[model samples]
Target: MRLYVTPASPWVRRVRVCIDELGIGDRFEYVQTRWPHAWGTRTVEMPADFVEATPVVRIPALVADDVTLTDSHSIIDYLDGKFGNHRLLAADGPGRWKAQETNALACAILEAQIMRRAELLRIGADRSDDFIAKMRDRGLRCFAALEKQVPSFGDAFDLAQITTAVACGYDDWRYGPAWREAAPTLTGWYDTVAQRPTMKATEPAETPER
Candidate 1:
């Protein structure tokens, strides 16, 4: 399997952390993407070749002998089912649903943050102020809700733990550590995860575009 991803992407980080945690890191080659630049400066669009390779104009596209999967959640599902030896998601029942629910919330928070960043990059103030504010509020509300729900995990790193950690990390990267003051429980959870070797290995850093 091969994974085309950007190191700074939390979606890619999730997949990388999972691969390392599940001890399948040796199976795949990690390809740092050049398509975003190939498309255009400061644009989300990718070139036709990249699109043909992976329809989603995003990072963490997994390509195997018979499968080419995009989207973080779908990649996770594929990995878990293929490598059932180390199950991150619950095999069945309510626990699986709970994990899925947390994943959904985390993804929503990420999407909001991404949108906010993209809007900031736009050359003009052409976007609706109300829309941006609503997105910001939605992200904050999701973080607050996670703070309440995440405490149940205690000291273990499961799917919920990984997803929430990535979400909080993304917030700190795109927004700032101010979110910590508002959501202490989530702060603690993320701090604990940050110490883990897997999370540390996948941490994002800002860089000038090449």
Candidate 2:
């Protein structure tokens, strides 16, 4: 199996953390990708095979045998099913729905953070302060929602927790500690989860632009 990744991507970090938690890191060959400074402008030059594996050109793409997964959600779902026996995430029942709900909130936070980042990276004149403010507010709103859900997180460290932790970590890495103001409970939970070896190993960094 081959997993295409970039260290700076919270999406790719989620998949990496899931693989490590499942103790299946040895099962994959990691392929590194880069983000060009002209990210939103022109085509990115990625490996031919990676392009073939995911025409949409997203990172965290996984190619295993005959299966190709182009997104973090699909990759994590496949990993949980094939290597984790549904341990990372529930396979059915009310637990599955609950996990899905929490994951949705976490994923939304990640989306907002990433979108905010993209906007921030734009040239001064090209950037939209309104959009950036919108994303920041959206992310804070989701963090508050997660704050309410934290008490019910239990001690499982499942997919929902992994994704939430990733979102928290990403915000810290890219946006600093402002989010902690809105989600103090989540802030406490994340401080401990961030100590996990998997989280430490996958910490976000700058991906060199092309």
Model 2 root-mean-square deviation: 1.0
The ten-residue window of minimal lDDT in model 2 covers 35-44
lDDT of each structure?
Answer: 0.76, 0.91
Error of 2 at 130 (Å): 0.5
TM value for model 1: 0.88
Give me the runs in candidate 1 sitting further than 4 Å from their true place: 35-49, 127-129, 207-210
Best by TM-score: 2
Residues 95-194, candidate 2: write the lDDT tens digits: 9999889999999998998888878878879889999999999999999999999988978889999999999999999899999999998999999999
Q: Candidate 2's C-alpha lDDT?
A: 0.91
- Once fitted onto the true fold, the runs of candidate 2 whose alpha carbons sit more than 4 angstroms away are none
Task: List RMSD in Å for every model shown.
Answer: 2.6, 1.0
- For residues 1-210, write the lDDT of model 1, one tens digit per residue: 988887667888888888888878999988777533323225455556567668757777888898888878788878877885437888788878877788778888878876776665545566566766777888888888877787466454767778888888888877787678768988886887788889888888652254
